[model samples]
Target chain A: SQKIEQNSEALNIQEGKTATLTCNYTNYSPAYLQWYRQDPGRGPVFLLLIRENEKEKRKERLKVTFDTTLKQSLFHITASQPADSATYLCALENGSARQLTFGSGTQLTVLP
Target chain B: NAGVTQTPKFRVLKTGQSMTLLCAQDMNHEYMYWYRQDPGMGLRLIHYSVGEGTTAKGEVPDGYNVSRLKKQNFLLGLESAAPSQTSVYFCASSPNGQGPEKLFFGSGTQLSVL
Candidate 1:
């Protein structure tokens, strides 16, 4: 079975420190990967997407790295702020399928 | 732009009742999906539609039925609501099936089945 795994633990960091989140998968070779941010009681908002052929993609302060060879992706937020604190989700498109599977997500809290 | 919009931000239904949740997108997207999020669980794909009048089952499609009668609308129906079905339902749309098309999501609908 295809499995997607994100850091299940909540990450706490200072406001100015960079926050890193990891997403690992097994048994699935996805064509594309995406990250989303969600706040309490709200739907997730699209952040960045990196294809299997692409190494990295960035949008503003957010960055995503895809390593198909390693079966992993890393999401980064540089110079993080309190407003950047939210649950981050990593999703991968199933091989030759339209469905995107998501990991459980990691909650990041930035303290000022 | 309204982007993606779902009806009834909050709903409470008794077990065995039936309800339909409606989603509409104005982005002229070709693909629309329905998902359910529960505590400690990532968003689970319930059903999706590639285009109008085309619906397909997803990973967790057993208890849900969906219809895409229009280009911009996707409807999810719960025939016999159960407490296990209570979850935050989200609707998302993508422009095309091309690589890495970002999804536009609605605020979500919270359903509580008692």
Candidate 2:
């Protein structure tokens, strides 16, 4: 069976510090990987996407790296703030259907 | 513009009850999907539609059925609700099915089966 794993434990960091989240998978090869940010009581919002051929992608203060050889992806938030705290999800194409399978998610809390 | 919308933000039902969830999208997307989110289990796909009148089962589709009678609407039905069916249901839509596309999601419906 295919599996996607994220850090189950919550991460706490001081505001202005960098926050990094990891997503690892097994038994699957995906062409593209994506990250989403989910807030309390709301649906997830798209963050950034990185292709297998691309080592890293960036948008504003966010960056994502995809390493297909390791079947892992890393999401980073630079100069994080309190408002940046939320559950981050990593997703990849499941099969030929063009659907996505998401990881469990990692919760980051930024303290002022 | 309303990208996607789901009706009945919240609902409570007794076991064996039947209900349908309505999802509407104004993005004119070619693909739409239904998913359920639980505490420890991120989000699992329930059912999806590639186009109008075409529906397919996803990762978790045992207790659910779906209909895509219109291009902009998708309906998810539960024949007989169970306690395990209690979850937050989300509706999403994407522009096309060619490759990886970002999904636009609705606010979600919280259903509780007792």
Candidate 3:
């Protein structure tokens, strides 16, 4: 079965340190991979999107790298702050259904 | 601007009861979707619409019904609520159905089935 998997356990890191989260998929060739941040009791907000052809995409303090050959995507947050603590989700789109399938997500805690 | 709005921020229903969750968007998006979030399951798509008057089944469509009667509105109906139906429901819309469109989501509706 096609599946998207993220680390289910929460990640903890000190403020100002860099935090990395991984997303891995099996049996699916996605055209696009997207990241979203969801806070407590709120809807997810789009963070970044990286195409299969692109190795990496960056937006300010956030960076995403997609490795199609490895079937994985890594999300990085530099200069992480306590405010950056939230659940991060990765979604995969095959470009055929106009829909995205999401991973279970990684909860990051940036402690001050 | 209210990008996406879901009415009744919270709800509780008994088994076999019926209700409708309303979603509205102001961006005039061409695509709208309903998703339910549960612990350890991520967000599962229930139903989606490409445009007004059109709807399609998604990854998890059983026990749920959807309608896009207006361009800005999408409604999800539960004919007979079940305990398994309890989840945080979110409504999202995208500018178009084309490639790599980002979703703008509503605050979400917390539904509890008893």
lDDT of each: 0.92, 0.94, 0.96
lDDT of 2 by residue, A6-103 (tens): 99899999999999999999998998999999998788899888888999999999999999989999999999999999999999997778999989
Summing lDDT over every window of 10 consecutive residues in candidate 2 chain A, give the lowest-scoring window: A94-103
Interface RMSD of each: 1.2, 0.7, 0.6
Each model's TM-score, in the order given? Answer: 0.97, 0.99, 0.99
**lDDT (Cα, tens digit) per residue for candidate 2, span B1-114:** 888999989999999999999999998998999999999899999999999999999999999999999999999999999999999999999998887799888999999999
lDDT score, residue A35, model 2? 95
Best candidate, lDDT: 3
Best by DockQ: 3
How would the docking of model 2 be graded?
A: high
lDDT of 3 by residue, A54-75 (tens): 9999999999999999999999
Estimate, for each residue in B41-114, the C-alpha lDDT of model 1 and write its tens digit: 89999999999999988889988999999999999999999999999999999998676678888999999999
lDDT of 3 by residue, B54-112 (tens): 99999999999999989999999999999999999999999988888899999999999
* All DockQ scores: 0.78, 0.86, 0.87
Stretches > 4 Å off in candidate 2: none
